[model samples]
Target: MNSILRITVCAYLLSGCTFANSEAMPYKSWRLGFSAPNYMEVWIESADVVDIKEQVYPRAMSGTAAIQTPLNNTGDPRGWPEKPGIGKGKNVTGADLPKKIYVRWQSLVEPQTYQMVINVPESTRAIMRKEEKAFCAFDGKWITDYRNALVINLAPGGMAKIWVMGSCLPAIEVTKVKAVVDPRGPYEGKSGGKYDKLSDQSKAYVEKFGVPYDSWK
Candidate 1:
């Protein structure tokens, strides 16, 4: 009778384990924080594109047309992890940066969407177009990849305050701006490498046994 009871208990526990593992996991969303704005009712992102880019230069020479291409070094579809071309600029020594402050919204959905609201100074607003691309330079160099540019179209003026909203996270702010154009995606660079393969569960086996705990009378 004791042996039969032990077998019944083992079956019950195994069924519970299978049921728990079969349930699907729920999806969750998160919001990453940036600097706060000085004003309220600032229009946030309703929808926008998240662009990424990278450099693809096979070789570099001392005197020749500098080659630049959109590419990524990492094999992951997310785009290149680093942009090396932007570091070739004169270093700044405690330079005061212009205040073009804004807040970028980072919500993780299926495709992962982003939106930003930037308050451009009145002086730079007059020239701001309906669709403008601004090169996002970080630290010192022009970010050539995932650290690419933020495509924002601001109202142009000398001192008129305008709110610029768009999709995609902004480049690291400390980096200054150099050029402007439409934002692009990560460049698909070299593609000739093998990736790690996943293992099959069928090839592995586990020992199955029965053990009894005795506390019942």
Candidate 2:
């Protein structure tokens, strides 16, 4: 082959190899799920890494940006519960009740698990244990192994299908479940300052599952 043609072919082959290597790298993927009573907002932020931007759910807080459960039968075509009392064999309809919310994200560079933190609005009244089952799609199949994931519970007042958040938790050796409640009102302490005033157990929950500062403001 001519010199120029040989060089061009070699360059193309090198580029192809590079692309293949990039594609083969197992990019990190994450899924986060949680349930709460009342309007709940979630934020995922990096603690060790300064460059990684914090992630916010619902994108915006106004209008339809808030993460919430279905409003009615028309709102939930999947037949998920739209109100509380499903466990008691009773049906109740309302906007303010326990609601489930889930968020997911993936990245080419696997995030440092220990540096990750979760933040919620200070308005959160209580964190309830999720009694229902949750699932996620992996390799085009649904995975229901809760033991392999982190679970956070909150008592938001609404009803909807199981849509829980999943993601990495820092320093978590095994799958962990955490529950927490805000002791103050939405306007209390100007952000999550109230987190510092929580009881020892509640404070430990914030340390383990939540970011150091409030992300709501």
Each candidate structure's TM-score, on Cα atoms with residue i matched to residue i, is 0.16, 0.20
Backbone N/Cα/C clashes per model:
21, 26
Kindly list the per-residue Cα lDDT of model 2 for residues 24-66, writing each as its tens digit: 1111322223333222322221111000122212311111112
lDDT of 2: 0.23
Model 1 lDDT per residue over 1-217, tens place = 1232234334534553221121111112111112111110011222111101111111110111111222221111121113212211121112111122222221111111122223223233222212334354444434222212222211101011122222222323222222121122111111232212211210121011111111100
User: What TM-score quantifies how close candidate 1 is to the native fold?
Assistant: 0.16
lDDT of 1 at 40: 8
The residue ranges of model 2 lying beyond 4 angstroms of the native Cα positions read 1-33, 37-67, 71-146, 157-184, 191-217
Worst 10 residues of 2 by lDDT: 106-115
